[model samples]
Target: MIFYGKQSIAQSDIDAVVEVLKSDFLTQGPAIEKFEKYVAEYCGVKYAVAVTNATSALHIACLAAGLGKGDVLWTSPITFTASANCGRYCDADVDFVDIDPSTYNMSVDELEKKLQKAAVKPKVVIPVHLAGQSCDMDKIYKLSQEYGFKVIEDASHAIGADYKSAKIGCCKYSDLAVFSFHPVKIVTTGEGGMVLTNDKELHEKVLLYRSHGITRDPKMMTRTADGPWYYQQIELGFNYRMTDMQAALGYSQMQKVDEFVSRRRYLAKRYDELLKNINNIHLPDQNEDTDSSWHLYVVRVDFSKINKTKQQIFAEMKDRGICLNLHYIPVHTQPYYQKQGFKDGDFPNSEKYYEEAFTLPLYYSLTDEQQDYIVKNLVEVLQ
Candidate 1:
């Protein structure tokens, strides 16, 4: 069955991992540094810290941002739970800003409004790049400056995406940005992530937090070392280091990111053309200032116009040997978040989007013929 997302692995990817297995160091080695440097250069960021996964990356970024008990963190509700959960990991109170209907990203207007009225402003605001399209980072940055909050971009779906000529991970509009390298993401490291930042202090903090807050560096140490083997646990942190094997594969994947993004963009345009005339189906909208990576091709099916529920449509697609998926359920609607006092109508846009949207097949390896077949089945199912 054709699924919503899949990784495109080349023989070189395998060779890179195999080569790492033959190398001297498997874990805290040169390969991770190499991959980090490559990604930092590609995104035009000053520093990068590779980690085990995006969730860990987010957690470290939150800690580095000085998020703690009594501080508040905010993000778009239409994202994976990790985006909001990272705040909870820091013992920070988590909140959500509604999304822009057009971009499916955190609305700067909503953020500013919330800030204007809130007695407790957020310590950090994480605007997720949903479906690989960037939120209005320029405006978000402006708001952050005015309100004195940090910005951490949840760029898991947007490694190869661009906003106003600069890549998403440049951190020009945010203090730090994150990228995921899961199998279904733009690039695969068999499950890896990187945090990019321009600030040297934040970069150093992220590095410290990702690896148990330990430091062997003399400059960061509280006292002089007794011997070369001296180290100290400076602060509480997690074991979030990425393996050399994963970094090696990621480094190799970096070589083909441009090609991968190019193909995804081509497919996205093709889908737009193919679906334009279809009835009662709204296409995903794009923001003029951003170029998306198209990690997901989600469409809102007007179930009210048709006789079927979303489940019926999903079942029909599955019967055609296609497995579609939903991008998210609003974070606040989850039982855990509801216990935090966020109710059904707290964020209307995300909830509405969740109800109407379902992702179509999208991946680097998806062929035109396969896409056409999927589209045909979707059209039949919708009818």
Candidate 2:
């Protein structure tokens, strides 16, 4: 019964959802704005816009970054499909940068090499914080400056994480950041997301885009107001608004983000110590001056040294009820991306990661006993 990842719901979260259900406003109400405020403050960012999901947040973030038809959007290949799909949704060309073998995030070195050899400069770059570990954003932001591209940090796995002693969503290293609140994430709102930005203009643009591109405020209106019931569709946008019920659950969950992270940290430390001597497996990496939220607890298997294959190990773990998983397959190798002209050998490092990576059970409520059982089964299977 130990799933790879699961939401930890508290009594407060349930009560908050119930309160929202009993309230007069269910969809677009005070709770939504309240949740936004909570996230903004928590991340140390100036503004935040709540949305239906991380995918929608990424889409709007791309729009706010001025991506459109004929423009090129670049991101790491080792991420969920949503990271790259945001660009396609804007009718832009999408490309990928390979990842660093050690951290499993986009490599600044590869990004620089790609820029040097490019005939067309990318207009947007999304650096994903895979598995709640922040990417090397300062270096990426430096390249962004030299190349004149906007950056959207896809921090779906890194809500409470920190880079260089600052919160991940602070926008200190990128133009904007997106966070997920799906059930498996550190925080849960049933299904929700938020985009963070310090730039007032981008914040306003996202706000406008969240609600069908309709603006009721006079300042953003392109024309004179018709009456008190006046509103305008300033741009073509989507119905990406989050509901008050979800926001209420998020708000309550936000109160426990620190506690959740602490428990995950403790569990991760235990795993590190317990498995440190296993020569055939490597633990997750931690860069200098950063702390991850320890989202997935992915470990890499050295298949060349082991008697069994990754497939065999995975099957054994599952058969023993460990519920192991892989964080991703290289996105460029997906059928959709292959049709876009990307194929095997386009990104060797990401493909290599796909071959060896495996995710262990990670969540706030995973007991020490459960984790030990999981690791014991994995070790025995590997032998």
Candidate 3:
């Protein structure tokens, strides 16, 4: 069966891992630094801190931004739980912003309205680049400046994507941006993530938080201690460091980043062309200023018109050798957030999206023939 997402590994990637295995150091080594440098340079950011996963990266980023108790964090509810959970990790109250129907990212208009009536302002606003399409960062940045709130771009799906001709991780539009290197992402580090920033202090804080909050840097120490062996625990932190083995894989994958994004875009274009004529289905739209990485090919099917529930359509597609999946359930609708006082109608746009959306097979290795087969199966299911 054709799966929704898969990694594309080359002989060079295998060779890089083999080389790391033969090396003396495996975890804390030059490879990790090299990978960090590679990503920083690629994204045109001053620093990039590699972490165990995107969740850990988000945790450190939120903490570094001074998010904590009494602070409220706002983000799009149409995302993975990690987006909101990161705020909770900092003891900050989490809130949701509705999404734009076209781009499916956070709606700036909804955000402005919420800010106007908000009893308490958010300390940070995390705009997720859902499905690799960027939110309107210029507008978000303007709002952030006016409201005096920090912006953390949850760009897990947008590593190779572009916003206003600039790379997504450049942090041009936000205070900090995060990227994922999971197996299904544009690149794979076997389960790794990175945080990018231009501010030296924030960058340093991220590095400190990713480790045990201990610092080997003598400059950052409160007082000069004994010898080179001297170190100090500056703040509370966690073991969120990415392994050198994973970094090596990421370093190799970085070489073909453009190719991976290009192939995905090509496939997305084809899918759009094929699905445009099909009724009862809605295709993803690309923002004029944003270049999407097309992380997942999600479509919204009007179950009412198709005479089937989403589950029935999904099952039919699966039986026809298509391994389809759903993008997400609205974060606020989850049991945990329900306790947070969020109900069904809290965010209408997100609830509507969750009800109709499902992801189709998309990956670097998906052949045109496979795509045609999947599309054919989808057509049959709808009929």
Candidate 4:
């Protein structure tokens, strides 16, 4: 069966991890710093802090930005729960912004409308780069300036993607950006994440927060104590540091990021050409301005024209050895959020997307033969 997404591991990636295993340190070692440096250099950001996973990166990023009780955090509903849960991690009120029906990213126009009617101003706004296609950062950046809200880009799917010729994690348009190195992502570290920022203060805070808020740097100590043995617990933090074994794998994978992205883009282009002729299906959009990493090749079915419902289509595809999967459910529709007064109609576009959108097979290692089989099975299922 063709998986919807998967890792592309090689001897080099395996060797890197093996070398780490043979090294003197496995966690909190030189490999972690090396990996962080590689990502920071690649994204052209000043600092990169390695974390256990993207969710932890999001939580620490929200905390570093001062999102807490009495503050509202806004994000797109069409994303993994971590995008919204990061806000709740800080005891902040969470709210959803509808997505653009075409791009499936947070809609700047909807955000503007919501801000106008919002009883309280949001302190942080997280715009997810859904399916590796960046949200309109230029417009969102303008809104951020006008509304005085901090921007944290949920760029987990977009490490190798470019937004207007700028790397996604450069933070040229936002305060901080996060990337995932999950197995199915552009790169694999088994499970890891990184936070990138241009601001020195935020960078320092992220480093401190990722390691239990304990600072060994004498400069950051609250009071002058003994000798070099002096240290301090500056603030409450968590053990979110990524292991060196994971970092070694990430470092090796980072070397081939361009190649992985290029392959994925090529496959996506092929899928786009083949699927465009099909009726009752909407393919992903990639205008000349936005270059996507093509993390997942998603298509939305027009249920009105198709004889089968989404469930029936999904079941048929699965029975035919095609592992299709949905991208997300509207976060506000979750039972936990419903108790917070969120309901189905809170974000119309997100609700509509959840009903029809599903991801098809996409990965660097996926061959043309596999893709052909997937497309043929999909066509047969729809028929």
lDDT (Cα atoms) of all candidates against the true structure: 0.95, 0.93, 0.93, 0.92
Per-residue CA lDDT of model 4 for 209-293, tens digit only, reads 9999999887898778788777789999999999999999999999999999999999999999888898888998765678999
Error of 1 at 17 (Å): 0.6
Per-residue lDDT of model 3, residues 17-133, tens digit only:
999999997998999999999999998999999999999999999999999999999999988899999999999999999998877899999999999999899999999999999
In model 4, which regions exceed 4 Å deviation?
none
Among residues 3 or more apart in sequence or in different chains, the pairs in candidate 2 whose N, CA or C atoms overlap within 3 Å are none
lDDT for model 3: 0.93
Residue-level lDDT of model 2, residues 219-293, one tens digit each, is 889889999999999999889999999999999999999999999999999999989997788898998867999
Candidate 1 lDDT (Cα, 0 to 1) = 0.95
Candidate 2 off by > 4 Å: none
C-alpha lDDT of residue 22 in model 2: 96
RMSD score of candidate 2 (Å)? 0.9
> What TM-score should be assigned to candidate 3?
0.99
lDDT measured at residue 289 in model 3 versus the true structure, 0 to 100: 97
Angstrom error of the Cα, residue 222, model 3: value is: 1.8
lDDT, candidate 4, equals 0.92
